[model samples]
Target: MADVACEISARGFLNSLLREWTGWSLAPAAEAEMEAGPGDGRLRIPLPSRGSVVEIAVVHRSSVGLHVFRLPFREHRAGAPARIMAFAEFAAAVAHEPAIVGPEAARAAPAFLGRVFQSLSAIEDALARAPAPGLGLHADPSFQEAERALRFGHAVHPTPRSRDGFTPEDARTFAPEYGRGFPLRWWSAAPDAIVQGTSRAETAADLSAGLAAEDPALDRRIPAAAEGRVLLPMHPWQAARLTLDPAVDALFRSSQLIDHGSGGSPWFATTSLRSLYAPHARVMLKHSLSLRLTNSLRLIKPVECARGLAVDALLQGSVGAAIAARWPRFHILGEPGYLALRGADGAVLPQTIVALRDNPFRGSGQRPAAVLAALCEIDPDGRGSALADTILRIAEREGGGAQGAETVALRWFGSFLDLVVGPLLGMQCAFGLLFGAHQQNLVLGLDDGWPAEAFFRDCQGTGFVREFLPVLAEAAPGLDLGSGHRFTAAEAARIMAYYLIVNSVFAVIGAIAIAGLAREAVLIRQLRRFVEALAGTDLPDKTCLRLLLDAPTLGSKGNFMICFRNINENTDVTDPLAHYAGLPNPLAVAPAEVRP
Candidate 1:
């Protein structure tokens, strides 16, 4: 395993620890004041348990609150000579310190540290088999290839790459970064056991034929399975897990469920480990899993499945058609259907659930629609990212030989504002529909190196602004917006501002800065202009815009808090919003500017 890869992961973890303590007001008055950038010096953090301080050097600062730090954290104790501590020790120290994470949260530290080590091991394992990040920089890769490109996971996450309930071999075979593919495990379920909601012309049975086509050998055998039942496909790892469940075994013996074993084309795991993709498949299959990934268990909830159908129905109605008419180039990858098994006891099996998402990049309709998270991730070699390489190429070729990278970056930033950012805000402004367009949820389609269009996915995350309910009711009379899909204006603005601007756009800005292509201040100024441009328009909802322009801070999901407390995100119903915390707003400080 490459030690440098481990070192990068280690540095990122510590940087996140410092960012949380500093940005979230967890650190004390002294420890939270460390500035980032060249010549800013190192940050010394106290390890209360060991009675020592770990000093980390600040190499670069992100305008989005997370800073890049130098590794090899040195532990300084009172009388003894200073010695270097490894990443494991650092993780333990953070858990041991109540001031860093609250006393209640510190109790969950041991569980947190276990996952941290698992994440490091997973990173090392993936790096062994995965292609070098430098390779993806130049190539116009396939959608699946781009999906496999995230070497270092979430930009600011503490345990970004960890996998729970995964053996090293299972991880290698199933994780996206490993770039491995295996056929799906299929189970045939009786009609009574199937619970399905579809907006597609083809049912799950029809889609199963598509999967069968990918493997000619399985095509003939599926006729028997497809005769009178729905063929449910599962992620191979999830299938092995369900095999051990007594509930699943009972169904198999009772003839309500029949195992079809592993068949069809080998679908590669995407960045979201539970979601699988085959190049020629008609739909992207998202199977439910019992495993915990990051902050949530991978089980697919019934309410989420219901939301996908509801959003699809809404898009097919008046509101969607109106939005499409205004932004002709804008698109949403509609999830037409979801299927799950219902136990004989009449309860939905979360593990048996699968969501069928529209696949615009699969088969004949394929294009270079790159997931923004994968594009913005720091390359494994630590040179830069795929975003850096692509943006630099745009500058070099499209800058007309006179303008520099920064100038081209400014122009490119403007186009991005129009293509991706504008419609996203416009959807909320005019229609009250909020897509959870975080880096992982949104994809950008490139045209000769420039962003030409955007695709938003994850229909289950769609939200309606409560203030605009009357307007929505009038526009789409019979539209079923779903039960808990509504958010108050303040709630909508806070979460939308974070996902769209802070989490998504800031990462794009940071990618440029981290690549040494341009300063973040310049891009922040351009972003300010983009918001001003919106100010020039007559938006239906300005609450979100107002937050971006005026608020001193925007709400951000605290990954550190979630990890420290061992919170299961999907299962948290009563206080799911409690994980959100305020992040220092960079735009509030940027000198406002507008250009015609």
Candidate 2:
């Protein structure tokens, strides 16, 4: 029981007083220090700010957004006192949102607060039931059961999405669901037998080892590798929707073996690709960010999302090329999502792959500086020009110049974001930022005692807009381009922060963390350089303030990139195209290979 500290706004002060009429301790302590949790956790107030103060002035001069009060454990115990502090915060939050909680009714505050307490208790109790330390981040119930089946000799295979195929009686015998699922953990030997609970329908016949042997019912033996390597055949259903670029596909199919992991969203498996070049193997798979569930079922907008993703993937490829090209001496591998040396069977050799994770802000500890430097030295002219020209031509065929909706131009901007800003940012920030730019999306490829390379994926997380339709139409005839809308100063800043600063910076931090160094120094150094660079360049006022002030300090190494939200509409603000000024136009289109 930590000491409880609480704070409420002036508007909620009266509500608390009314509730405390029956007597409640609003303030527990006078003041307390705040402490940050271990590694990227929250920094919260350690003790109560005021003694039984329901409403008090916040230290706004020092804090931003919301005020935090530390709960003092010395005074507040688990029984009634802890409940009091928790309820106070909940009541204040509920009162503030009249639309959700409803207006102040005649009900007493304590009664209302008690209901919230009960709900919290229920949630906490439910959380205790979870198998892992954190909910939703670990294996699911199905995964657990599958592991059990494998441990016993039985194999489990999944049923296709069909109800009619299953007889009601048969379904009852196997829990109504059957299938080969991703193996979170592999089993070496099968137990003697599997015992079923009384509630489960009895399968009188003893379960045998070959149960998964293509039985008309269930098959649990999935496509696995021989000799610690498994070749997970990308289900034909999944391959049907992937980006069909020859280069992208070549890299994708080259994985020697794939093993399924826990399934929830964007189901994934581990790859032995890295094992070809490096000591430890790594996993490679397409990220499933857009795929989610809702109450309503409808046709997914695949073409629209895929187009954006394809463009993003290409841009990411371009960024990788720029880095590799700039520093030939460094071991730079350029694949779609990443590059690794694989054996003839498409299995990555462990020695060829780096076993390090990517972290951009490792304080004074340095990463493979060559990669970062190479990214910065990218021939912005050569690759950037070719991409711009290629996209315009694609837009033309897609009806670019025709005045209508801004679809063509928006799509082009999506590609542009992938190619141009993505590459440029990869240098100053590190290549991994192109991924989700969030901690979870990043992985470190360690080599020797250092981080060797940074990899990024999840295309949707990257941001770009289609404001350049008019510009493209003016340059290329017979193209459908939209009359773009100019964003206000504030709106532009917000978009940049959301897409580039906040989202992208976090990815770099994840990469930097794996370098095994204190992030503070790295973040400060990067921040200093980023701020200094942006200060000279013309940028929105608000964006500048956030980089200098609002950015979280945990692993933020200065802000390095500014996403062009209003690419065409606001192009004149800071011209990415201007970088090509006076340079020989190397992007002149050659005969492009057209697929039938």
Top candidate on lDDT is 1
Tell me how many clashing residue pairs each candidate has: 0, 66
- Candidate 1 per-residue lDDT, tens place, 49-163, comes to 6787787665555657656565566788989987877767777877778778877745687898888888888788777777764523565556787788887787777888877
- Candidate 1 residue pairs that clash: none
Q: Tell me each candidate's TM-score.
A: 0.93, 0.34
Candidate 2 local lDDT, 1-596, one digit each (tens): 11110211211122222211222223322332222111222212122222222322222210111112222212233242522344346344433333322343323333344333332332232223212111111211121121111110000001001122223332222211122223112111111111111101222111111112222322244412222332222322222333243432444464422333221212112111101111111222221211111110111222222323333333334543556685332222212222123344544322211111112322223332211111111011111111122223444555655331134333433332333233334332332222223322222232321233444433323332333333323343442222222343333334434334433342232222222222323333444444445445443233323433433321211110110011121123343222111111111111131111
Assess candidate 2 and give its TM-score to the true structure: 0.34
